[model samples]
Target: MASLFAFLRVISLLKAVWTAYSAFYLFRNYLAARKIGLPIRIIPISHTNPFWMLVDRHFISFIRQLPFGHNSFTRYNYRGWELADRYFSHHELGDAFIVVTPGRNWLYIANPDTIVEVFRRRTDFPRCLELTEILNVFGPNMSTVDGLQWKKQRKMTATCFNEQNNEIVWSETLGLANDMINYWSSKALLKTVAHDTRTLSLHVLSKAGFGKSFKFEGHDERKESSPSTSYKDSLQTILENCVLIMALGTKFLENPWLPQGLRRLNEACNAFQKYMTDLYEEEKQAFAEGRTSGRNLMSSLVRASQDEAKTGVGLTENEIYGNMFVFNFAGHDTTAHTFTFALYFLAANPQAQDWIYEELCQVLGDRQPDEWNYGVEFPRLKRCLSIMLETVRLYTPVPVAKWTDTRTQSLNVGAKTVVLPPDTMVIPSYASVQTDPKYWGSETLTWSPSRWIKTSNSTTANLEDEELITPQHGTFIGWSEGSRDCPGRKFSQVEFVGTMAVLFRDWKVDPVTQSGETIETARERVLRLIKSDSAPVLLLQMLHPERAPLVWKRR
Candidate 1:
């Protein structure tokens, strides 16, 4: 009885000590932040905690709904930047503001010049390697590695995204878009546009990355519930179940006693590995015989690996597979989500569609999609490019995440010198900066695709020829900025442009109207639905795109 009472006393004493220590720790950080003269918001929990993240996220959201709280507090997720704009719309956060949470400090930057400085000084402000560790599930790939390993991976993969690969993307995308358009046209009312776009992206990535092709169809369209282990089935399964793979890992799923879903995942991963291994062997044999064409990304990576093998700097088998998976993951979903957003934007605004169709008519003339060469035809379709650029600007698929140097770093925020602590996360809010009126005029919040294009003659009905405006440095970072920017920028551009030309050239799309809603009202409702319903999934996408069915008609 005495020992039990003593143990209870110890537990109570420990809890009291912990509470005091936590309070003192937070108070110390508060004083430190005050000394630096920066705006500070102290939260009790770490943003990374799943439960606390959910709670605080909802707390901020709740605050945002209360009176002017909507204009005061930033929400905690991807759309957090919406309220971030309200907070820093006038540069109230100046170059950066400090967000102090338990055991972590986040410095969110809204200033373009400071963002450029952060990007330029890579050594001073390197990538948050810890944040990307999830991407290293298979092995150390380009997205997750840093320093020498990342350099080697990047050099090997860089050659794969050249002009030749882009040409392949352009041609393949045209074919896929044509097939997808046919599929959509067959639908009584086109729902599942998001799923359809994802299918199209996966097909394009397959052909462009691995030189594999497939007919466009719904994800669940296979007649057999359990298809044989083929490249299409295996790759699709892997892509769709990435979160599961990330959580449970390849090893965990190997257990014989696991659930059917996990067993399926294991089978899919094994099948994908087999497919990749065969591809690697084929490429190796071709390289040995000096017959390598380097047509697709995989072939290019394989060629690079062979060349590096002589110098003892080649990617290992695991590294190669990791990179290939990363490429598929990074390339597939992001571009697909971008496509969905751009499509919705175009459908909502018929004027934008008209502009795109006009440019397509002028650029392609009477030439069919097959005849439309990447080199000749792609350069002429600037409006299509503008639509993509505009969409990406507003709905950036991936936000930039960097951290302060190991040593304290000084930043010039307006006229003040702010010293950021070592290892503090530095997020350049792309949504806030890209939409800021200082760089993008007063109508920055509006989805006006024309903002990206400059007309030669404002009054001329011939809007066929217009120059795409290049935003000032650091102001436009949809594909990100500096050395670590996305390598597949051109790949995505080629695919997006090709898909747009193919789909919108001969047809018009509008939201399906309900009982008494006119086309214009439906369009307005769609615009609202996208604004309200769109949130980040794997990427920023229409949360429930099926809620708004689109109708297609020949123009």
Candidate 2:
């Protein structure tokens, strides 16, 4: 029996290796065969700096014809942020058009109408592809759950984030903001080191999303505010590693012989799974006994998964955890990145930041913490909100969004017919739409909040029959377009607004370093790279020079 089992393992191992190589070769062939339309134009990007150089240029050629079609590339200003843009955008075949990922099972698309249709069908457009590891590693959590399951999970997950629930959540956001802003005001260090906004925001999400209080929020004896060991850092590392191992899954799964790294990763997944299971059980028990209102997000999910009200389809505890992890990555990283990038632009344009601060004080005027929630406080808040929204529009958190259509349906895109069968990779040109001269106006590239306020200077374009999707345009599809977009949108927006209000109400910021650096990172759901080691940091308390540099005094 033992010998037979060993022999079976050997066969499995060889098959996995073969499949991996076959997948790689298939992708290479696709790349070779692909070509761009001649009249459109193509820029040959050197394989070496192709990604970063393009991102450094923000991908929208400032000078269209010169550096574009010539085997060269354009990128974002931040070098680290460019990699994702490269994987997501391509114009002419090899130039800046589509990327034929490995397995040949997916295609990276940037066409405007093609992406719109992909988003239109929530059932068909799944966030995951066969090559994506987020779904496999995390399981059917809210983030990866699709079809009816996603819809159900999204509903259960949303109860905690609605405007009605804002009061409940404000307790946490306001508290954290106070700590963060005040601490910055008191810091002695003129310089500080922290991960880009992605990581910093993760800390905020932990407190807001899962309902944990921040360890580094207020007047601290603590100096460094980064995630400390076992729980925070380890979890982030495991998630990032999940992305890595998934990329190498074919080789690792082959040979039935478990590699040490794979084995270790598996163990971590199991442990993480177990942790989630325990929490679910606890929440379920509390709700059952009527000891808790099931107010936080986890409790809501547990209740729904166990609800007799939910017939036919329901979620498992493990699945909810998987979703929570996705929520963590999406909510945490996207929000944080937006905050960081917004700060970068705001700092670069201090006049806008100052305007925003002045607006806040005008409406807020010695008001108590909860006063901003009422109807009277809206106008000033709206202006501040518009600035943040505009910042995201200018430098979106994610450059590319990729999905696969699982339905045997067709959608019309201009003159072309798109047949989306199961696993058809679809990509959206997010950076283009946000920065399009036609829709947002030629001055769209300029980082100005006044444009979003709908002034005479506010311009509109005829991209589609409907008004271009702006903040005023109902929902910002940057979270995604259509029903299939991120369910966590409302949740993330609230977290962002709450945190920003708290911090900015107390400080002023400007770019003193890493101002022109480009963002670079490996292509995936979330970004992890910073443009440079000297990347810009939001200076604290400009009001009192002697206090903390991270926090400035209110003028």
Candidate 3:
């Protein structure tokens, strides 16, 4: 006991000394950065400092998540686009208490033209740091690779999202959705408790992406029961474990040097890698047995791996690992939020939901199945879909899109040129542009999907929400710009539509209480979505945030 006590004392002393040193170093760096005219704001707290350390660390992490949902409304996009505006306009939103990592470091680009230039110059700004690192956890999937690696993987992987591939995925996706609808009908008295949009998306991703059938049909004799979780569930457990902890910036939540937290994190990562690696090898064996593809994302990934084997330069396990990371967070979050928010807009404008139903009836019969072939029906529903896109713009799932400076030369920001030392980080402000009075007209802040209707009731035809913003225009960039933009956008679109179409066709979302406060999506400079809590395991293909604060009535 004495020896153990003594060791703890020694460790405590060491941590304190290191923290003091870090504090000194951080301050020195901040001062030097300030002297060089960088936007470096040093925090007064240190990692070893008392409560402030937790505040500083979590606040920073949460700040990054602030551009959307609760955080954005709470903290001003958590200093996101406004941060750039402040950097540009010399306005300080924060006290000295909130510090940036020095220098107008990385890249400070806010103009539409420059946004085009950055996306166009592929090598100049490729592989966003956070995106790439997170992708690494997917075990060498196309999402993690750059250059030839991405290209090769993109080829076979692309097939998985093709119309036919999507048809297969969506069929299963709708099956899950139908099941959920039935379940909700059975348990109408649940009062919609114990549900959220995120879980819905996770369930859909599990089925559509991993091919795990989770019976959403509650106690229905005709419907299969929700299956016990399989490997995909196990894998997801690890994935969620890693993202939640890592995204929160662990040292902030717990002791930085706590072996317990670190070890838990490390274990999650290792377990995930092992699981994915083993699955990949098993797939390789299956391919050798002439099994090219199965029903889910794993099958598609395995097929890609098989193709990669012939090239001898196939995607590394890292790429596979990274993409899993991408799908779990990016794949699920954005689509789920879109699905959820679209429901909010539709409910707010039930006329539009009825409008959507009218279109669905015209395009697809009441009994029409959920398949990619029916994707053609989505265009008729585009007006409603456009409203959904607007929701994404007004409430970006991600607050900022970032890239590390690969430029050897100074990036000229019109009048003032900021020379970005190689490997600096620069995050573009999509949140600002989406809500900016400049591009979106004066009332950009309000939720008005009617703005997307060009002819209104003039009886017009259109395709799925003709992208309001493109990589070319830099308008609303929820999926980001550049070659590194989410390759899964199409996949997300399909999932989102599948989820939305079925819900509107069968149900009416009425407010439970007229006086209930409608929660606005928050936005910090960075964005994190805190979805509504009322959504059930309605396993439509995407996360359905609309589940919150509403009662689903049978139409």
Candidate 4:
């Protein structure tokens, strides 16, 4: 009884100490934030704190139930807060503000000019490697490095995403989309639109990224390729359980006492690592033998690294594996989520489907899917490309984070130039600026692809030319901006356009209306689903996409 009482006393004392320390730390950060000369908001816990992230929504829910708990600080003290808050916070606190917390001060900027300056001065504002360290779970790759190491990886990555690779992405995406459409058409009402699109995306990545190809399998049709594991199964499992893998890490999940699902994820991690190793070995052998027929991303990357290795400036074997995983991770989920969003938006707005179909007809004419050329027809499908752009405008998957590491940086925000302290995180307000009415017009929130199209009279007035409208530098950072923009920007665009062309050219998707529900009501439901049911797991995506099944019909 004495020992129990002593233990309880220790716990209470420790809790008190922690509370006091947190208060002091937050106060210090607040003082620093004030000196930055920006509007400041305070939150008790940092959004990046892993333990807090795990319980953020639940804790906030409990807090809101208490008196004086429902406030901006509680609301915004979570990861992916930008998705919910949007321009409202920026409106309240001007174009720039600091969110001060015990962990760090986050400087959120919505000003386009300031954002452009930050992006251009990469050294002044470098990537927040601490936040992105999870991406190095496999090994140090392009996404998780900086300085000279980043330069080397960037060069090699650039080579892999060349025109030849984009062509592969285009062809492979078309084939996968065609197969997926056939599978979708067979169903009366498809609840697995998100799942199917992810499958299509994974297959495309497999073909283009690693020279591996898999047939598109519907939700019901899928079977494990092997009793133990298959490449597709491993990759799919890893991607699906990304948050779990990232949060708990592979080492912890691999423990034998873990739950069955997590153990399976551990198996997947091992299987994927093995698959990458085997591919790396094959590519190395191919290079040694001078048999350079492979043109996939993995092949290109391996060849480039080999040539550079002779000069002591190439990616190591683990680095190659790491990059392959990162590319697959980046290319797969980002496009798949965008595809799901675009599909739902199209289903809700049938006119948008027709808009893309019109462009497809204009570009492809009498040519079959096989005859469509990437270099020629892809550029002509402006409406299709616009759909991708507009979808991302509304729902950016990966909002990037930059920081001033160990250096005081000066940034011009509106009329004032402010000095930021070292270790300050500078996040571009993607959600706010992308949808700001000042730049995107009054209907900024509406998912209208036509907004991106501008028609002009040519020299002969009879002929009209249409082109995509270029938004202000920082307004539409769908693929980001400046020096360190997404290297696979064109790769994703090619895949999206190819899928849109194939899917909409001959078919249109409509929300599967519930019993006694009007088509208008069904469309509204889908729109609501898109707005409310979306959040970031690893990236922002529709959470319960299956709740709103869709039907594809021949137009």
Candidate 5:
């Protein structure tokens, strides 16, 4: 009894000490934040703190139930806070503000001009490498590195996203989308829309990135194929359990005593690594033999790096593997989530579906799907592209993070020059800036694809001649802005447009109505689901998309 009391006393004392230290630390950060001359909001915990992130939802929920907890700092200091807060915080604290926490001062900027200045000054505001270091598990790819290393990787990777590769993306997407539509149409009501889209995206990436193609298998039709089928399975497993893999790591998960699921993840990691290694050797051998007919991303990347090696600047084998993984990571989930969102949005809004269909009919006419050339037809699919753009504007998959590392920096925010202290995280307020009415106009929150289209005044002008509305410099950063922007921007665009062209050209989708529910009610339910259920896991995506099934039919 005495020992138990003594242990309890020690625990209490430790908690008191930690609480005092945290208070002092937060106070110090508050002083530093005030020096920046921006509105300062104090938060108890930093969003990036690994411990807090694990239990944030539950803790925040508990906090909200307490008196004065709804407006507490815990609310804003959680992952995906931007989605919940939106432009409200900016509205309260002007275009730029400092979120002061014990760990660091986070400067969130919503101003367009200020954002442009930040993007332009890359050296002054490099990416937060510490945050991205988790991505280095494979190796230091472009997403995980900065400076000259990033330049080398960027140059090599950029070559892979050329017109030829985009043509492949377009062609593969059309085929996969047709298959997906057939699968969906066959079902009475499709619940696995999100899962199916993700599968389609993964298959597309597999083909476009590695010159390996797989048949689009629906939910019911899914089964292990040939010996190489593990390649797809492994990649899918890695992506699905990416957070766990990143958190615990492959070595830790590979332990024999861990759970069966974790063991499978470990197996997937080993399998994927081996697959990449095999592909790397093959590509290197092919390059050595001077047989460079392969137009896939892997061939282009390997060849480009090899060509650069003659000048003593080439990606290492591990770097190639790292980049391949990053490409798969970036290309697959982002597009898949965007597709799911657009599909849900379109399902709810039939008029928008009709709008895309009308453009498709006018652009393609009686041309068969095979005859739809990338160079000729892709440019004319303005409405299809708009759907992608509009979807991303509302829910940007990967919100980029930049920081002033170990050096104090000055940034121009409107007329004021703000001095950011060293170790300040500079996050572009993507949700706020993209949806701000000042730039996107009044229906900023509304997912209206037509907002991006501007019809030409010339009476003789063809539908293909319609131009896309260019938003203010920093307002629309779906693919990001400046040099470090997504290199696969056009790749994603091509894939999305092709999918849209196929899915909406001759078909329409509707939300599966519940018993005694009207079509309008069903539409509203889907809209509510989209608004409420969507959140960032690896990226912003619909959480329980299967909860809201969809139905497809010929228009």
Candidate 6:
């Protein structure tokens, strides 16, 4: 009895000491932050804490209703830009502010000039690898490294996203768009737009990205070609259960006694590994025999690595596989979700669809899908490109995350130089800056794709001749800005333009509505559904897109 009491006393003392230490650490950071002269938000728990994620939804809702509430709550899940704007209306937080959470300080910057400076000075403000470490589940890829390692991964990866690969993407996208149109046309009300878009993106990535192609099919269509697991099935499984795969790891799936879901995940991991290994061996053998065609990005990467390996500077087999998976992860959902948003936007705004159709007609002039030359026809599809840009502006898929170097950093913002302490996270709020009224004008919040189209110099010209407006540097970072900007920008653009041209040319889409509801009312409801349904999963996506069914009609 005496020993038990003594041990309990020791435990109590340890808890008290730990609490005091945490309090002192937080107090010191708070004082340092106040000296920096930036707007501050003090939260008890770090935003990244998994435990806090459970209550985040309720916390955000409660905070928004508070009198004169600041944008501190914007750190929670989706619609961060909208939250930022509301807070901006209520406070004078300038272009940037400090979010002091627990023991860390997060510096959120929305200023265009400051964002440009941050992107340029990569050495002073490198990415926080800790956040991106989840991507290294396969192996060390481009997104999870910095300095010489990142440069090495980037050098070979950038070469794969070239003109030839883009041409393949354009062709594959056109083909898949036709297949998707056919599938949608057969249905009275299409509820699988998101799934269909995901499949389309996966197919494009497979062919143009990995030298593998599959026929486009509907969500209900199931025709397995592989003996064990289809490549598409494996890839889709990986994408769907990415967080689980990252947490438990690919090897965790090996235990047969585990839960059914986890066992399936294990099967997926094994299937995908076998697929990658087979492709790697084939490519390597082709290279060894000097018979390399280097048709797709994967083939190109393999060829490049082989040539570099001779000089002892090339990527390893595991590195190649890791990067291929990264390409799929990065390329697949970003394009897929963007396409989903574009479909909904078009369904709501028929006028925008009409504008794109007019542009397509003018550019192609009744040319068959196969006849449309990527080099010649793709350059003229500015309207399609504009719609994509506008969507990205409103809904950035991947927000940029950078951190201050070990040394302290300072930046000039609105006649004041703000000092940042060491290891502070510097996140460029793409959503906030892209939609800021100061940069984008009064209708910044509105979804008007026409804003991206510049009038032609010739007064007699029609819409087709208008040029695409290039937003000021740092103002529009849809594909991000600077040396680390997404290398697949043009690849995404080409795919988007092709899909838009094919879909809008011969078909029109409108939201399914009740008999009593008017078209304008239906449009408003669809827009609301989109805003509400969109939540940040791995990327921003329509969580319950089926709530708004779309009907397709021949134009």
Q: Model 4, clash count? A: 0
lDDT (10s digit) by residue, model 4, range 138-166? 88998899989999998887898999988
* lDDT computed for candidate 2: 0.50
Candidate 6: C-alpha lDDT: 0.82
Q: What TM-score should be assigned to candidate 5?
A: 0.96
Query: What are the RMSD figures for all models against the true structure?
Result: 3.4, 10.1, 8.0, 2.1, 1.8, 3.3
1 against 5, candidate with superior TM-score: 5
Q: Which ten residues in a row are the worst by lDDT in model 5?
A: 221-230
Output the number of the TM-score-best candidate.
5
Mind giving the per-residue lDDT tens digits that candidate 1 earns over 475-525? Answer: 888898888889999999999999999999998899999999998999998
**lDDT (C-alpha, whole model) for all candidates:** 0.81, 0.50, 0.53, 0.88, 0.88, 0.82
Q: Rank the candidates by TM-score, best first.
A: 5, 4, 6, 1, 3, 2
TM-scores across all candidates? Answer: 0.91, 0.67, 0.69, 0.95, 0.96, 0.92
What is the per-residue lDDT of model 2 for residues 101-216, given as tens digits with 9 covering 90 to 100? Answer: 33333343444555666676656566653333434455666545466776777766665465544444555555656656655556543232233344445555555455554455
Residue 144's lDDT in candidate 5: 88
- Evaluate model 1: give its lDDT: 0.81
lDDT of 5 by residue, 369-441 (tens): 7879999999989999999999999999999989999898989999899888889999999999998888888
Question: Order of candidates by lDDT, top first?
Answer: 5, 4, 6, 1, 3, 2
Clashing pairs in 5: none
Write the residue-wise lDDT of candidate 6 on 367-472 in tens digits.
Answer: 8899999999998899999999999988878877898868899876657788888878898877677877777878887789999998776875786569998888
Candidate 1 structure, TM-score to reference? 0.91
- C-alpha lDDT of residue 476 in model 6: 88
For residues 1-555, write the lDDT of model 3, one tens digit per residue.
Answer: 999999999999998997787667666646544543444434334322335433542465565664552342233222232422322222232111123332223334455665666676666666654444444444556544556766777765665565654665466556666666656655433333123344556666776666665555232233321112245445444544654554544344344465664555544555555666777787778888886555666667767766767867655666665665566666765665566556555655567677667656655665656433545654455654666677776556654334545555444443545544454555555545555665667676566666655542335454333333232377667667766566676667666666666766767665444234342331210012222222112111223332344557788
